[model samples]
Target: MNVSDIKWEYIFNIELAIENFGYVLSGIGYTLLISAVGFALGLIWGFILSLMRISQLTLLNKFAAIYISFMRGTPTLVLLFLLYFGFPFIGVYFDAVPAAILGFTLSSAAYIAEIIRSALNAINHGQWEAGMSLGLPRQKVLWRIIVPQALRIAVPPLSNVILDLVKSSSLAAMITVPDIFQNAKIVGGRENDYMTMYIMVALIYWGICSGYEVLQRKLEKQFGSY
Candidate 1:
């Protein structure tokens, strides 16, 4: 095979490739689903963990500290293996897609918790005092004023992480989620167009990540005045 003169048609056929494009889209759909679930779950879980870290109660604070430390210290790949394979030893068998989502969510929550905690700490203590002077309850003050500003500060980093999650979701192929890369691999193998198929997949990832970068910049600009 002359590498330079390799004539390639769209795999199976151009019509077949088009049909499989729909399958590839399905894979991307599942990828988006996993990211969405992980992001939302992480947001809620991380918010609670942030509060626990800042709590005055010794036990609550200590538990949160350990949780954050452990998660931060461990690799996400190891965490995913534990959730998918190790948990089954204890009679907890999560399906592959769910396992991937849960693993990503746990990792995301740990990072987001720290982000929230640091953002909260960054505000001047006088702000809390000012809120109290205005007769706002502590929770009300946090919800209305402190959290809003903290989220503004956190958005840039969080958006970067979310974009990372989207790319990281390629790992879902390991658990058989049929994600974009996996579909590309399958098609590339059948048609022996590995380079072309994977190149297309890479372009897809780059396009999505670029969109996220644009969104992140817009967010930072919008929040700069706050």
Candidate 2:
């Protein structure tokens, strides 16, 4: 397939691609599922960790510090491999997808915790004092006032983290998880159209990330006024 000789009109093998498309689509579905579950879990875990970091209890703060340190120090792929391969010795036999989710979620939780802590710190001390003066409970003040403001300030970086998560999902292909890159590799091997397949995959990823940016901008505009 010389550059000039390669036919642009060369029809994409839709039938063959369709037959294999399910695997590809399944890979993408797995990618999205892992990201969604991982991020959601991270949010909850991170919130708790953030609270712990800010708590007056020395033991809880130490635990949060250690968890964030461990996860942040390790690469996500290494973490995934550890969970998938090492856990079986301890009787926790997670399949590839579950392992990926678990690892990513753990890693994400660490970063998210730090992000939330920073956001929490960014809130003014006056806000807390004012809330307390109004006779609002500590939990109520955090839930009803502080958290909302912190989240708005946190959205930009948080959105960036999500974008990284989406891209990081490509690593799942290494474990034969059938994500977009894996799909492109398989198709390119069959058709010998490596460039086209890769280009298409890049476009797809770009499309998703671009859409996220648009949504992020809308969110910033809508909520940033606070």
Candidate 3:
């Protein structure tokens, strides 16, 4: 077909895309909710795993290592399906949002654990000795002095993980969660403008990631001073 004969209108109807903008935007709330909750829960769980991985106990260290390895080895989508679809076999049930949150949290925790563990390892041994010399108990020193410094060191990497979680939130669409991607699909189907709607969705994700990048830089600067 000649270029002029191509049905460009079907591929990208800008007016239809514009009309459905609200539908796509509406999913942002669910996207943000999933990422925020997932990141927070992941951080908490990851910190616990980090502590276990670094502990003196052999069993704790081994368990943490295995758990982290398994989680990191699994693809995120596979994990999402396992939780959302596979759970029913074990008689556990989860709504789409909860299942997505659980999957993201589990997947993110593995990476976060490694990030925290590496940060902890980067601290000079003298810091721990100094804290001890100051008459602080081991637990006190860990919680107060060591962990604070490690977390400061971890800020940059953890920010990246948070951004990843935000992007991964889009995968919730597979489980029927009405996240941004799902909303875009719905709008595209209704408008028959898949290309336009998907491009708009991409821009929305890009905008969110770009905003986080700015915050990450500021955080790095603030933490670098410490």
Candidate 4:
């Protein structure tokens, strides 16, 4: 069908959408929870993965490389299904929310690891030499001298990962997590106004991502001075 042939006016119910907006907005809590917890945990795990990637131990380095490769290669939806559904086969189970958080964490960590790894490598070898000249141990040089500088470079990409996690949290609906997109689906089904409901949900997501962009800027400013 051609775009001009479509009935745009009949496809959206602005009044119905506005009245049910609150129900959709109510799901933002779950959305933020999944995104924030997932990101926080992923950051910790990803930093470790980054360290492992850079380690001299071949076992740790190869393992980290394979992990990052696997996570980055697979679709997160498959991961969510494995966590929420497949785990029950082995007598391990997670309700939708925990499953979603786990999925996002596992998925985001690979990207975060790469971001951190590149940032670490990007730092000049001069910093390492300088730290050694000061009689600091290698670990101390990494943590005290290199990491702080690497963090500034890592901030932008890390912020992007958080924003992506937030947006991707919508997929939690597939596992019945009742996030914002899920709630929108509920309202849409109830009101039979799918287009309107989805449009509003998209706008809400845009608003959220915009807020994260602002936060990213603030983080950049803070880190830029460090």
Report each candidate's C-alpha RMSD, comma-separated, in the order given. 3.5, 3.5, 1.9, 1.5
Candidate 4: list runs displaced more than 4 Å.
1-6
Candidate achieving higher TM-score, 1 or 2: 2
Task: Rate residue 168 of model 4 by lDDT.
Answer: 92
List TM-score per model, in order: 0.86, 0.86, 0.93, 0.96
Q: Across residues 1-226, which tens digit of lDDT does each residue of candidate 4 receive? A: 8999998865777888779889999999999999999999999999999999999999999999999999999999999999999999999989899899989999899999999999999999999999999999999999999999999999998998998898899999999998899999998888777899999999999999999999999989998876
Tens-digit per-residue lDDT, 1-226, candidate 2: 6889866544454455555555555567776777778888888999999999999999999999999999999999888878887889999888778877888889999999999999999999999999999999999999999999999988898888778888888877766677888888988888776666666677677877888899899999988776
Q: How accurate is candidate 2 locally (lDDT)?
A: 0.83
Q: On residues 48-135, what C-alpha lDDT tens digit does candidate 1 reach at each position?
A: 9999999999998999889989988998878888888899999989998899999989988989999899999888888899998999
lDDT, residue 16, candidate 1 = 49
Candidate 3, residues 41-100: lDDT per residue as tens digits? Answer: 999999999999999999999999999999999999999899889999999999999999
What RMSD does model 3 have?
1.9
Best by lDDT: 4
Q: Candidate 4, overall lDDT?
A: 0.93
Give the candidate number with the greatest TM-score.
4
Clashing pairs in 1: none
